[model samples]
Target: MMYQEYVDAITPDQEAGLKRTNGRMLANTILQNPDCFSTSDRASAQTILDSINSGVQQDAVDQLHDDIEECVEDATDEYSWSNC
Candidate 1:
């Protein structure tokens, strides 16, 4: 199967796992750095949050694009146009 197909097959499951992992990471960070949520730690927290959010958004977009490609491929295959 193509890489895109693999991504399309795995994305939804991966997303759930990713969310759990992110939740654990946040919990650990809070436990390790109790002050990290304070006004004094705003900069650090903001940086971490931004990075996590960006990564999640990118993953979601990539997965969506992969799924769309797979759907198009399936449609083409149904019509026997998949020569690639």
Candidate 2:
């Protein structure tokens, strides 16, 4: 999402961290609704990503990364790997 866009313009290490965080969020969302990941019912997921990409600002990429980390933490109760 926003985190992914921000991650895209960062260094490899940071990018890897962001990817991991994104994967965690995606996994959790999928866990809540598997169809969102493996079926044709991914409209909501796409919309979230679209919003993130469209509204994300270069100055906010770092903040977006932190936001994703928070999201992952809220989803999994763990912020270690989620803090991209």
Candidate 3:
């Protein structure tokens, strides 16, 4: 199959490199032509680049924070110290 041959051609590392390159190119396009995307899309794209530069994706960080908060809340609720 054409798809199978295509898939077999590139190694995992090569695929990852290609994906990163494509993402950078897309980000550059978004920055150079803001009109192509909606306001939220533009903001999201910039946030992605910011997260990449900072060494982690913003969404993953936010989700981690949220998960931690929920865990803390649950633990506190499980050991309530009620006073009269």
Candidate 4:
């Protein structure tokens, strides 16, 4: 479901016993979800999101991944995660 994407993404596996959504997963989500970002933002966002997903070969991308992960982890709840 549309909602499950976020729920799965936000909950850290550290506590939920679920797989924490890593950069790769987040990248996949970005690639797969058309509505997650604005049309103007999607192209650039996907590039960075995908870059981080790939084991963060680039330090900048890695930092970006960390930032995004932190933001999501801090901001999300079940309902929001549910509808990512």
Best candidate (score: TM-score): 1
Candidate 1 lDDT over residue span 1-84, tens digit each? 332343344444577656545544554454456654565455554565676677779989999999999999999888796565
Model 3 vs. true fold: TM: 0.41
Per-residue lDDT tens digits for candidate 2, residues 1-84, read 543453354456566446545644653454466643555435655664555454455437888899999898787765554766
lDDT of 3: 0.62
| Model 1 misplacement above 4 A | 1-41, 81-84
lDDT leader: 3
In candidate 4, how many clashes are counted?
3
Candidate-wise lDDT, in order: 0.61, 0.56, 0.62, 0.56
The residue pairs found clashing in candidate 3 are none
lDDT string for model 4 (1-84, tens) is 343564465554453222324433554555677777566556754775665445434656878999999888777754576755
Compared with the true structure, what per-residue lDDT tens digits does model 3 show for residues 1-84?
A: 232343354456666446445455555556667777778867866875665555436556888999999999998887786452
In model 3, how large is the Cα lDDT of residue 71?
A: 99
Q: Among all windows of ten consecutive residues in candidate 3, which has the lowest summed lDDT?
A: 1-10
Judge candidate 2 at residue 84 and give its lDDT: 64
